[model samples]
Target: MAKQAKAKLDRKGLGSLGLEKLIDILLDEAAANKALKARLQTALAGEMGPDEMARLIDKRLDAIDQSTARINKARARDMAVEFSALARNILSELGAVDPQAGAERILRFLGLRFPISARLVADSARLWKVFDDTETAAQELIQSVDAEEQVLLVPHLERLRLRDRYGEHTGFLLGLTSVLAAPGAHAWRDALMAVLADEPMKFGALDLAQRLSLRLADIDAFLSLEKRKPENRRDTLTVAALLAEAGRFDQALEWVRERPRGMRLIPVNGSLTSVGPEYGAHERRMLEAEILERLKRREDAQELRWREFSETLNPEVLKLYLSKLDDFAEFEEMDRAFAIAAEHEDIYLALDFFISWPRLDLAARLVERHNHDWEGRYYDDLAPAAEALSAKEPRAAVLLYRALVEDILRRGIGMAYPQAGRYVGELARLMPELPDGHGLSTHAAFLAELRRNHSKKYGFWSSVPGGMQG
Candidate 1:
């Protein structure tokens, strides 16, 4: 028996992205003479030894080889026919022969056709990259391109003025478009790429490129004024605005610098960090709105909007907006902040603001919204949990007294946590193994009191005995 021929597909050659199509056509041609081929192979194999069978396979491969060239020519003709038809269609979607539009169309053509194994189209993009290399490279580059690729781009570039980002920065249209068309920092990266094209030159290319490529860490380092003081930063930031069009700080960072220092490096690793020129809530909303609109991601845009009913004059206006808006999964940040605002005891408001709330609940949720100080909120929440322990509710007075002992730590007093001496004795007499001890970082004096009262049972003088983390 003769074995089937085996050969790997060749990826190289003109416009071979369509190789599978050509292969299909070759197989179809072979199959058309099915009866003749079967008889011929049977006779040939009968007379031929195994070594000779290999020669027959080689001959068959040679015969198939001629078919590939023919397929390529046919495909080229088909593409040109399609391109002409597509050219007429372009008049409808694209404006005119203006340089930008022509350049844009060239890019669009390259992008649309490359993945189909269209070797010609891939080469075309490469040609454009080369043309971008020098002043007169475009025409020479066109000459080298296959006749098919030249048909469309040659006519288009006659009037384009792309002196800014051509040459070594030649791939802006492809790379920038590719990056921006992707999900996140690609847009920002594309904006920064203009400097490579000599357009308002500023920061070092490799540095900016490397930094933006660091995934979500873009938010970690705020654009420091220090970077701006040395020149290029202002122009660079401007370019960033024009390229992205979203997150227009409008010199907002200037205002931020006037204030004292500290909270600079963007919200850790979150996207919208403010090094000074941070965007206000309204501005951030508008910018995000425009981008989503352009991307045709309207549903996502709408989802980012906060509620429309918040009072404009509220002290925590941003907080109110946050509660109304719903972009982030953590919907309760503003809710928690506002809830914390609505309570108190012997503590001052200014001081409560200082207590490092990095404190959270079971789900790492902020504890403020859990209604720590408000009797109404706590009674409402704890009511069910309290009822669950109804056997203890039977001992309500004693438990209520124990609850007061717990409050010594639960209160959101700033650095000031003066644990009243009254509830300590009963708490130690009851629940001994609470998660955190009585010696919390809440305050110095209060911690001292907790240690004295519950030293034998509570161990250390703590405050937040049951808070969770987010």
Candidate 2:
């Protein structure tokens, strides 16, 4: 006899239960769950009409706004759940019948952001995401309304914009660019310009106006606004990228060649470190190469790409350069690229390039040649490289494993003793297959050396089976 398959409990399967049964189940569950009860009541209110549904939602919103409860971490989770449910009801129930009313309600719900955020002791990411998602939904609802209706809602949008105390909804106006009629957009832009004129240092209005201009494909306006700010290397790169995207290759080339202003300080290892003016130099060069390509200067582009590859051992750039060559020329260029990588100053980068290129033989040789430069602390890289070479280049694998084991013991990282023991086991297994003059001592000699240096580390010795007798 065959076994029977279990029935799935999806909507179709649940529909097998009669309507009365489903209603009874819902009512029983709603009795115990307050959130469910509120949702059911909202759904019931919707059956009457849109007005009644709006009134019920407004009642809940008013209650939420009137509450002065200080929400700590424990309460935040519950608040997120409750608010998310409320937002769903507003969007689904009220939104389905009357989008304009729904848009208004969503805006009101969004307006609670400032006061609600102020009452929280800790920042609740989930709670904040609820508002963020609701803002997007509100924008969609507002767009669904007719043009005249949207025009009427402009004041309401302005109110919500003013309520954005934390600048969380900076893109609110920009998001409505497609929905706003000519007059509404003009009015909003004028309003933003007025704020900018009054407060020259206010970046928020400037950012909004520039983004709006871009959305409208008004590049001239964007550049005019960009020129109002202080010139910096980062902003220059941004403007160059914008120009390149707009197919203005000549202007982009000129911007990319502009001299960098000064050294920029960035966080490194929890400390501020000053980088040279050559920051973003590689990106600038790559952009210039692309622009040159667009200008029908193929040789200049190829030359720039080759220089970048030779300096950084960047395999992508090398591949891009070689791709533009004739069919039979690729083999010779590949040989040249390999030679350049072999002599590159950064050994690790060269190794990475060879590995990515899948020329494992060259990778193994590079490892063997730069044996002394392999630092065990970089196990994140060396360990994987060793594994990749373990099959055909067991000698290189042995070298990397030995470095990892020595570093662990030397640092007295007792937490890694088990891992060290495993490496020791791997070394013991690979020893018999090693060729003569592998530059590493025999397995037994290596074990003896370990015992002499790390004899005091009993924990490590204990982790190895047979107490290192192998």
Candidate 3:
């Protein structure tokens, strides 16, 4: 093996070289020695001027070619961490000197080197903070970069926007709006429109675009672009929302009306009736109701909402409609709705309504009345109802708990053993609380029945708590 020559460059000696030459020397040294590479980055950060620091940063960033920056999980992650910090330091230094220019450089770098360096910068809090900080200069950055260059940044910008709650970054949104508003910003528009045209549209992107359109008061432009593309259920819904928000109630009504009507199959005797449209009609109708209210026809809106709620039993729509009413009217109507819910053929909906209303008493009645036909998910509704009813009505509660336990054991659902055993423990506790002459079986009798029928289920037996293990 050939011996490599000793690399010697004094810390003081680095000052003799030009900024570019110093970067070259550092890159050469760091490439040879990983520890020195790591050391020089921090040591030079404080030692160098902002311009020199930017030069160092730019050199380092450029040097991270496909060969150097290629993701290797086997390599220590500390390298990526170090590089990310360097990128942030460079950006901040550049930003301090020239916020607009720095933002342009950052966007350009992100656009050009995203694929290779995305993982390197992924989750870099400092870089994201720089992005957040420079948001105010976002428009200047957009204008500085060419249309093609700005196109490269669309994805990163979108990512930054989506990272925020409701994509509300003011500066980042300004840049997006500029691109969307620009006559030549087709690449930007296409990127957003592509997301909209996705089989399942990207809700975040759609929301950001809508917000931008709203800011620009460009609903017609957005609708025009959407019309050029294939129709989607989500698009229709979005257009309806945008139009409604713009106080274009007549236009909003048209979008809602355009939705395939009656898409939901009406359940007639436990089977779906084929005559109606069903997939997304409920939401469309809800939008129509909202448009009615916006159009100053409050009575029409209320009646439409009430009819939809009665027909579909949609909790969300009901909640929206109720929110507009006074508390007294809301509760009174809720009481009326509660009565109607009890008779719903979909007993689960009735059960859900009672539970949501937190009317445990009414829920118990419904469960007891329809116990035989109750084919609801055990863990979801049954177990929860059992726990709720246990405090007030031990006999009724026992029936629900026993039903859950039996169902689990009958199905031999091993995953549910721990839960079933806990239910058994609840039954054990509740047995002592039973009133005299309660019609339900005693705890001992119930345990005997469980043992006789499910003695082979070792999974259930082993999970029974210490005292309850009969």
Candidate 4:
């Protein structure tokens, strides 16, 4: 039977045989001879057809990609060294199949680490060494790795930036900048410049690029590249903002003023009757205000910001206005601002602003007017406000303190115990001075409520000195 099979097999060429049949024959032969099995594996590694190698490599890469939990910097350097060998071997096989696609796949793997891989790269300088070694290996596999790889590898730059910012190691950031700025590294430089152009020059890139000996001209040139693109040109405000950040205030204002304006008709009594400059009017005005501030045109800046603040009661705008003036003047300004905040339809914002300002007189009045609105939030603000008012307005202060103590016990929040306990002690001291007809619960009744509701809170009991718990 073996002879007949052999004779029939001999009638057909090995290439003509079905792949499964050929594999079965090889397996049978290999099972009978260990040496042949080893030889077959070696041949598959070296002499396997491109299609077969690609399929095996794709399967292997899929496994590596799926087993993401194992990839991180905390792994020993030896492990990274081993993986470098494995990645190189895989890429070498892949390159034989299709160099460009193999390069893309490899770049993609490094490009998107998914989750904590960037963390891994960022956490240690040793891992950066591994990364450098891997880069060298990748270059060997992909002769002349292209500009796209630089784009793909940008997260490394970001990680380095973070490390540099947080004062991890100066050498690493400087070394990286130097390497990226090295001769024949135009792609790296361009990729970095492109990524950074989207971010503010003041925030990061300006200093880092300058560290690498990159001038403002190079940065401006890169920035203009994005501006030249049709899609990016639509957002002229961004370029204007960048120019402002670069201290070209006049140019920035010019760009801001030059934004294309379109006229739009307003609905008046359901008929289109009014025409106004529509596109970017609000944005342009805001930019102009910011530019005027930068130019030290304080009056113009204040006018624009105050107008916006009056219409919106935006606390940030108010803060910006206040920062330019003295602290003594801020209270007066805050009084005016808080009056507007009080009128705002959102009572929560009013309450929050009053309490945060510790405008206790205003807050006490607000709380008294809307006592039922208290739902146990903002005790941090309320507790302190109550304490501040205790000196002169013990009646109002007692009301707030009692409210805070009740809210704390009702909600079972523990962190407020120390502050609440201290306030309770102060309330006990103020009991003698509190007038009878002050319209607040009696000190005896407040003590009864506290013991009734929170007898079990030993932390609170311990914080309050004597028999006040009764």
Candidate 5:
């Protein structure tokens, strides 16, 4: 019988490379080297026959061709990930993106250029420091970061602004400003206001600053800036005009009363701040009411408001009022706060109303009216509310939770990590307190499984234990 072939089909040691690669290497060497080819040809001819030698050569060449095809196929499959992690390392070194560009652009470049996960977009963004341009185009990196995974990028974005540059490069600036200015984006209202003050254009800055200052219940910056030297008649006039326009009559009157007589020659033609005069208590109250009446007189004014009156009143004021109402060792002012809050139909007003009242029965009813998506935390109040519910009626709180969970699942709004986690943990623990014995452990277990299968979707920090807010 003819000698069995020396090459085995099982090419185990070569790892991913298959039988064809081994055959190709051998054949290439023999074909490229005249001495080797001649030597092998002679050996084959002598050992076997002309027909056998020819058949062996054909077999090897065919195998080599097959190996080349396999290599090409593998390359096609990995076309996207060819750069793998090396690309991320490269982007990170590039630092942050330009002030004009966002991190999403960077991630897009990476995904399109190198084929990476979409989530990596934010990682590219981190490499971009807004004021200093370097990491701008790494869309994949920035997206990866923005998906709430890093938790720090949003804050970082919140703080960055171009105090120096101007113009179309404003997109990045817009991105930072948009994020910081977004209602319910963060509790650090003062920091956001400070960033806004640095903007080169008056464009969105004034409005953002106004809303933030109001929400923060702080007119300190406003009052301070007003007191500083006026840069131009227009800037001062604009401030006064807006105050007057807003019907902050008392404040407006005071500023008008304070204006220097030297400026009287400038023109009362401008707003009160341009000339300066102070409004007394009676005048202020009367002016505030007049401004409201004037605003009401304009039918077109409805279109001017961004939100309901309560939502528009500045978060800080509402926050302060609500905190004072809750005053359970927090602060004090229950009666007046509730009286004022109840007069408004606003959900924001309702939050203040409930905080002042702290009645579980009222909270259960009010819960339906509010947007749980509010990024603000009420963890400390949760204990009181939960206890109130437990004391008043466990069944009712449990029922309310059932309704809340259903609504939450149905709406699919993205709750920030801390808030969602607190509610989930508290609810889960309170499951036993509910009328139904269907322990949240079952839901928790299901959540575990869901997370196991879809880690990114389930999100992390859904619930924190031991009553910790972070």
Candidate 6:
């Protein structure tokens, strides 16, 4: 006898159980579950009209706002579910019947964000996510409301912004830029500008004003706000990129040409090190090239692209350079690019380029040529390159695997022993396929060397299958 398949719990399956049965199940579940009961009551109120629905949702919001209890993890999760359900009712039930009322209630719900966040004993990602999602939905609802209504809601939004003590609702107001009518936008701009006027270095106000200006397509306002800050290479590049995007090529060019100042320090081995004023030189040059292209300086653009490619061995830049060449010139340029990549100072970068370019044959040859330079510390690049070369170039793969194994044992990185053990297994499998004069030791010889040098690395040998006999 064959086993029977279980019925799925989908709408179709449930419908077959009859509406009376479904109602009985809901009654049983709702009696025990307070959240479900509230949701059912909200749904029942929706049938009365948008007014009744809004009243119920407003009552819940008021109760939530008035409560000052510190919510622990479990209650936080439950509260998140409740808040999400309220937001859904506001958007679906109230929004469908009366968008204006729905939008107002959404704003009221959003106003509870700071208070709710403050009352939490510990951080609640679940509650925060609910708020983020509700904000997004509120934006959509507000956009759907009448323009005059949007103008009226600006004050409410401003109130919300003013009450945001923790900067939790960072983009809430700025995200409404598209939905705001001209009057509403002007009102919002004025309010943010007032904040900036009183506190010039206020990051939140200045950021909002600048972003709103861009949304209004007012580039001058954006730049004027930018000028308030001290100029640096990073900001200069940003202004230039924005100018280029706005099709003001000449001004963009001037911004890009501004002499970069100040040393940009970056983390290296858990310490800050100065990378000089040329920190983002590559991006600056690329942006300059783009501006030159827009200005019809094809030769200059190609020249800049080639320089970037030569210095970085970037495949994308090389492709862009090749794309601009006349027909049939791409093939010749590609060969030139490959030769440049083979001799690039960073062997790992060159390998990355070839692997990304899918020129595995050249990647294998490049690996063999720079065999001694393959560092296991750079397994990030070498491991993937080996995997790519395994089928067609097992010998090269063996070399990379050997480097990885040696580096792990040499450094005594116990955490990486299992990974090294896997590599050892691969080397053993690839040994038979290796031709003579590969300039690499046989698999047995390599294992014996590992044992001689790192005999106490039991963690590594144990992880290897067959106790390293492979």
TM-score of 1: 0.19
lDDT of 6 by residue, 1-470 (tens): 99997899998899999989999999999898767777788889988987898888888888888999989999999888878878888888788889889888888888898888789999999888988999898988988888766667766777787777666776676577766666667667888787776763543666667667877789999888877754431367768989999899999999898746776433233223456777678889999999999999999999999999998988889888998999999998899999999998999999999999989999999988988888899999999999998988998888888899899889989999999989988887888887777777777888888888988888999998788565
Model 2 Cα lDDT, one tens digit per residue, 108-164? 898898889889999999999999898788787877877566656666676777787
User: How accurate locally, in lDDT, is each candidate?
Assistant: 0.36, 0.80, 0.64, 0.59, 0.40, 0.83
Q: Which stretches of candidate 4 lie over 4 Å from their true place?
A: 1-215, 225-240, 247-288, 292-300, 307-335, 345-364, 390-396, 414-420, 433-436, 451-468
**Candidate 4 residue pairs in backbone clash:** none
TM-score, one value per model: 0.19, 0.77, 0.65, 0.45, 0.25, 0.77
- Clash count for each candidate, listed in order shown: 25, 0, 5, 0, 58, 0
Ranking by lDDT: 6, 2, 3, 4, 5, 1
Put down candidate 4 lDDT per residue, 1-470, tens digits, no spaces: 46553435364667678799888999998886543553455348557565565555555446655565554544635445444544555466566555555554554434323332433534545544555555555555444444345444445455545444433333333344544424324444555566664764322453344334433245465455434443322345655777887799987887776654454332233222334455555667778889998888978988887787766555677888788776698889877887787676765566556665556677667667766655546765566666677785676666676777678767777887776677778778877787667766677798787888778887777777575444
lDDT, model 5: 0.40
**Which 10 consecutive positions of candidate 5 have the poorest summed lDDT?**
110-119
Better of 1 and 2 by lDDT: 2
User: For residue 126, what is the lDDT in candidate 3?
Assistant: 46
The TM-score of predicted model 6 comes to 0.77
Global CA lDDT of candidate 6, please? 0.83
Write the residue-wise lDDT of candidate 3 on 1-470 in tens digits. 99996545776566666699978877997897654664566357546655565565566656654344545443425454554445455344565554444554565444333444455534444434444554444455555555445556566665554444432353355445644434325445556666675523333455445445554567776787556543432356657878888888898898778764443332233222344445556777888987898788988999999888887666776788798786679988888777778888877777776776578888888878876775424468776777778898676678788888888988888998888888888988988998888777778888888888888888888888763356
